[model samples]
Target: MNSNKKIIITAIDQRSTVAIVFQTITIGLIMIGSAVGNIGILLAIYKTKSLQNKTSIFVANLAVADLLAGLLIMPFMFICSIIGDWPFEDASCNLTGTFALILGAAGMNTLGAIAYERYCAIVHSMVYHLKITNRLILIVITFIWLEGLVLSLCPILGWSEYIYYTNEYLCTVNWAHDVSFTYTIMVVMYFLPLGVMIFCYASIFKVARRHLRQLAMLDTLSPPSSHNQIVSDSDTQPRIENSARSLRLKRDIKAASMLFIVIGTFVLCWTLHGCTMMCLALGDTCPVDFPEYVYTMTTWIAMFNSVCNVWIYGMMNRQFRDAFRSLCCIACLRSSNTQVIQI
Candidate 1:
């Protein structure tokens, strides 16, 4: 009996050890991947003049939020996962939690902002060109950051509270601290933004489809013999207007399609975390035995949003891919020059 008991205890310890190892590996990948992808996005945008536009401005804001999560919060979350304790002092803990929350709220909102920008740029290009200025976008971005600040500081200022959730190995806003406040945050900070993203993307898709149908009609009407026809025949004004509109419509479709991919990825990554948080908010207090690692894994899954945005940018946007390739080419050339100098 004694020998059997010893064997079972050893098996349990080994299982626990394996679990921790797996958790560490998972969190490490998320942390490293988020950092690398986000930094690359920033660098690629900075080096490419074509990408330095209004759409990219919103993306840059989102990147800043992800960069903060990777650089500041993720490492600590990883450390806590490994050690199973909040080793830092109370102040650092509170401040870090607040910072993460604010950035996260800001980042998520930035996605909505991007969606809105795309909707305006593509669905109403003429209006967008006339009314949307760099100064206006800058003001909007400032508002986003300010909104995040207010949401994050609310907890610190006693509207709600944030504390370490050991199960997830990160400090987050207290789910049950002030039930009403938690519900408010979940709705205002998360749901509304998600809805806006969905609506904007859906509207963009509708517009794109309508445009495609129009092009198909145009293709049917166009004659093969007119392939070399001049864009402006005798009515120069109407022809020029139509030509410009066609060009703007095509640009809008491409831009909107790219951002739609990004918003889809965001929805996928965030859904799991949102559902879990929703359960907590709704008072799901069943005492059923659940795997201890599940919550932490869910949180890790959310961290992947930071990682996926970069890949989405690379995959969905031609300009982004070209920018990345050019940046890599420059780096390679620099390395070769250094090698030649050494030789």
Candidate 2:
């Protein structure tokens, strides 16, 4: 009996050690990936003049929020996961929670803004340039940040409480303590923006498909001219203009599709985490008891969305891809110059 007890204790100890190591490695990877990817996005937008458009502005704002999450929140999470508890004082925990909330809200709102921008560009092409000015976009982004700050501060102002959960091993709003706050955030920050994105993207695609069908009909109806036929400059000019418009429309649709992918990924990454938190807030009324690790895992999955956006941009946007390549080349040259100077 003594030998059996000793063996069980040793096995449990080994399992705990393994879990710690795994958590540390996973968190560390997420931190590094998010930091590096978001930084690359910022640099790509800054260095490439072609990418400095209204949509890019919203993308840059999102990158900034994600960057902060990577640089601040993830490292703290890594430490806490490794130690198996929140090591910081109460004040520090509150700050971390507020920062996380701000970033989360800001990022989601930025995505909604991007979707709206695309919607106008495609559906209201005639007035898009006149209405969606840089000044207006800047004002919208300012409001997004302000709203995030105000909502995030509610907990500190006594509306709710930020506390560390032992199971999750990180500091955040105590959902079970204030179910109202949890529900509010879920409905306002997550679902509202999610609904906006869905509507905007859906409308944008509907317009795109209609335009494509029209273009196809035009192509089919137009008569093919013989090689010997003489074409007037006025006749040729209208065709050229129509062709240009068609190309621009296609490009806009493609860009919207890429952004839709980013929004879809966000929904997939966060929905599970949001549902789990809501369930926890429901307390005894909830049918299922989620494992402690489920919370931690879902949280990590949601945070990983920050890192995924950078890759998606690189792969989908030609301007971003070119900008990333240029940046990499510059960095390599600088590194070589440094080595030469040392030699």
Candidate 3:
């Protein structure tokens, strides 16, 4: 080749190499961080009694699902990015792609369950305890997992099938083929769960607003005690009125706050991808083609929803933080002991 042509080819090769390396490192780090964060939260929940509850169990299920995605799915995606092709054979692609889809579906379903749990606790406070038992929660979780598993397995069983996208550098459900099946799956798995989440959170927020308004009214009625006035039982009526529901209300409020953050983040991360998927499903051809980096970035952002949950829930709860600290201390002690023995 001439010097000028050779220089152009070298620059192109260099750019491609740099892009692959950057994508590989970025996804690898994301996987590591998500794995570590989710594992820490799991251990924290196991070790801390106070962190164990119906809602926490559901949240932990989400973490477990997301952790598996980070461990199984994201690595394969990064590998595809590096290789610039789908290196795996048909069976491997199907298995990994099915799993990735299953976990994602499960995570969203679990979030909907959490929203419903919060709604029940806040809106129908009277019957919430009776309605939301540990046994019942476990049953619901089992149903969520089973639903995702069944839907995910449909493709593997040859209902829809899996395809490795060369351009995007990922393996996912073959939604581009069989528009009818794609729309059906979208409605059953994605749209239904999304609708449930919206409804539950909306109801919870409405109840929260009403509760806050009531609290305000109560506060307004209870005037500050004057220095000259003698202390009276009437002065403490507001406290008496609040005492019954205060703890439960406060707990629900925190639960709502934490879960809201999670849902908001999840939606933010996945909205673009979801929209793109829907748009493609409706069109005659999957016309939307993003550049490699843009597609990869969007997918990773959605994957991040899984990793971010443990941090969101942990940060909001003191018990979880303490448990995480204890776990850290134990890890440190083990490292120190190993060093001493080596010495």
Candidate 4:
């Protein structure tokens, strides 16, 4: 084994056996949780007839991308953790690293799509129905995956390669001290998406507030003689408007809020990883041992985005939540019927 790999084994071996057990349990939990969440979203979307709307279609695509992340990346990470150094040969290492990076980028871009869609639905409600065609939504989804594919291929196409520091027991893209690359990635991957999401969400909040004010105005305004019937008519419109507006606002708020929180978590988790790479590129000696541990934890935190996105879908959207519940209930019913018949 390499010297650096020896150090990692020594360090991790120094920990109490209990610590290893706890770490194992945590990894297992994350794997299982991610599996259930992803599978639930896919099944629910496919089975629920009413959920065939444009918004749900996009959400289902997001769920599928996230599912790939959880299934493809998480297991590779777990294997790396159990064994110090890359267990696989060079080709496998490159493939694993590329898959993780691509799926992760795709998942992030999908969140951008969700944010933009919500922006139109809430901020430009009148025109949203007219302008947001099924074809347009398909184009957006296509663009997101394509962008991710191109980015993930950059490193493989002689731009960069996997660097296994052995000391880190992780595989990540090579970090060059090139300021231009650093700035470009930070802008493209982090800053641009973050900025767009924030802007759209801010607009969503403003529109929702205006919608509420409109409802209040309708409630306060009254009519003249023969006013009773007019008042009823006025009341009917506002009530319907308020109910629809409120549902939309609530859904948008939850979805946007969830994305913000998850993306923020991604930023926090990956910041140290990015910083360490930048420092390495600049030829600065890093506090490697500690930062490696921190980066590993952050990678898990970023992985949390995949697992959490499904829960967000279930929580924020009523149809998704209901469909998931119904699916579970039906599964149980089938199992029970099988048992009774067997008896």
Q: How well does candidate 4 match the true structure, expressed as C-alpha RMSD?
A: 4.0
Best by TM-score: 2
RMSD of 3: 6.0
For 34-72, candidate 3 gives per-residue lDDT tens digits of 899899888888988888887788879988998998888
TM per candidate comes to: 0.85, 0.91, 0.88, 0.83
Estimate, for each residue in 129-200, the C-alpha lDDT of model 1 and write its tens digit. Answer: 666689988898898888878888887888867777767777777776677877777776678888887888
Model 1 global lDDT (CA atoms, 0 to 1): 0.75
Clashing pairs in 4: 177-281
lDDT of 1 at 90: 72
Summarize candidate 2's per-residue lDDT along 246-268 as a digit string, tens digits.
99778868966886897789888
lDDT of 4 by residue, 153-200 (tens): 776776665555443445556555245655666666666777777888
Tell me which of candidates 2 and 3 scores higher on TM-score.
2
**Candidate 3, lDDT over the whole model:** 0.75
* Angstrom error at residue 106, model 2: 0.5
TM-score-superior candidate, 3 or 4? 3
What TM-score should be assigned to candidate 2? 0.91
Better of 1 and 4 by TM-score: 1
After superposition, the stretches of candidate 3 with alpha carbons farther than 4 Å from their true spots are: 1-15, 243-252, 279-289
Which window of ten consecutive residues has the lowest lDDT sum in model 4? 1-10
List the candidates ranked by lDDT, beginning with the highest: 2, 1, 3, 4
